[model samples]
Target: MSRKQYSKELKLELVKKHLEDEISYWKLGKEYGIEASIIRRWGHKYETFGEDGLEKQNADLCNYSAEFKKKIVLEYLGGNITSQDLAAKYKIHAPSTVRTWIKQYNNHEDLTNSRKEGVYLMAKNGARKNTTLEERINIVEECINTGCNYASTANKYGCSYGQVYVWVRKYKDKGIEGLYDRRGKNKAISQLSDIEKLKAENRLLKAQTQQQQMEIDFLKKLDEIERR
Candidate 1:
């Protein structure tokens, strides 16, 4: 026998009774011919994301296979499939992620180069950088000119808003010397010189390390298979 699809209102109404302890779940499930879990889900959703979660029936959610998704995206990036065609084929939860992956693949060389030279130093956390306080002052001024506010610049630079604000004032009056992060202020961000650069480089290195490990493990497995 096929299961019947009940409307959201009926589910919510049943959930209300369950919450009140007005009826046993077994009796309620038998009465409505729905699973006990469905009733429990309504209660859990109410506790978490709240009533809006009530509208989502599991069937509405997508369940694309990860391997299939990667294959389709890679083929599309190679010009073997159209964007709309791929979208229809694999019901991606967010198609934009595919586009981003393709963009990253295309820019891999530039990204790799950026990671190697100390140009990637912004991504490193507590390392000492040769770039002086003057350069930081100039970047902060450029950031402000580009309409970056104190908070955003702080988050980007991985420094406190207080530090960025003081630097901005110093850069305004005394120039680069004024913006020089006072030592002992945030020994970390100050020592590193460019917190954002350091963070980005470290992130890239971690990703590369993981990828290298996976490749090494795969090669080792392949060698063992060939010997067999």
Candidate 2:
């Protein structure tokens, strides 16, 4: 069955009815043709984000810093504000963004790492990088020393500015341990040093250069034989 989408105005009306009229979720679902569970979720989002929580968000439209996400998640968990209210306060276009952050925090997932790097969200194109724990610590420290200059830190570290910003925020919120890569199963870059990474890249470049040189020499020999 095709899922029905509700408009912002409709969602607001429904939530208001649920709240002011104190109607049951089952009754609301029956009246609106939405499931009780869905109504409950809507009610929760309404409490968190308000009317804006009902609006759909464009996936490619925005990128939020890790610090902002952490703050929102913590605030929601703290029970002081709804996700909708937090979204409005932060000027976040999507309330669902807060929902995702809250879910990940509850799951004990590291929010510092971008999903592209196997964290939470899809990586921006060609922007994903493998950074070690030590490197993450250094990056965060440098960002702090530079007054949280994320762009400069990212340039110095050859990483995305967004990634650097996240690392610094995570460090401040969770201390040094937050920078640690927690995935035990996918540990390809674990415990590796910056020097080791550079050396590996250098080795690959040298091998490619040698192969190119060999091809050039073979072409030269072939040309001479053809001239004969």
Q: Best candidate, TM-score-wise?
A: 2
Q: For residues 6-109, could you state the per-residue lDDT of candidate 1 as single tens digits?
A: 67688777866764445866778989887888776665544322233356343322243345545655676455565566666666434443453344343231
Model 2: lDDT of residue 182: 66
User: Where is model 1 poorest over a 10-residue stretch in terms of lDDT?
Assistant: 109-118
How much lDDT does each candidate structure score? Answer: 0.48, 0.59
> How much lDDT does candidate 2 score?
0.59
User: Any residue pairs clashing in model 2, and if so which?
Assistant: 48-82, 48-83, 48-84, 48-85, 49-83, 49-84, 49-85
Clashes of 2: 7
Candidate 2, 37-96: lDDT as tens digits? 988777655443334346665332335667767878877766667779987898776666
Please give the lDDT score for candidate 1: 0.48
TM-score: model 1 vs. ground truth: 0.24
All-Cα superposition RMSD per candidate: 20.0, 22.9
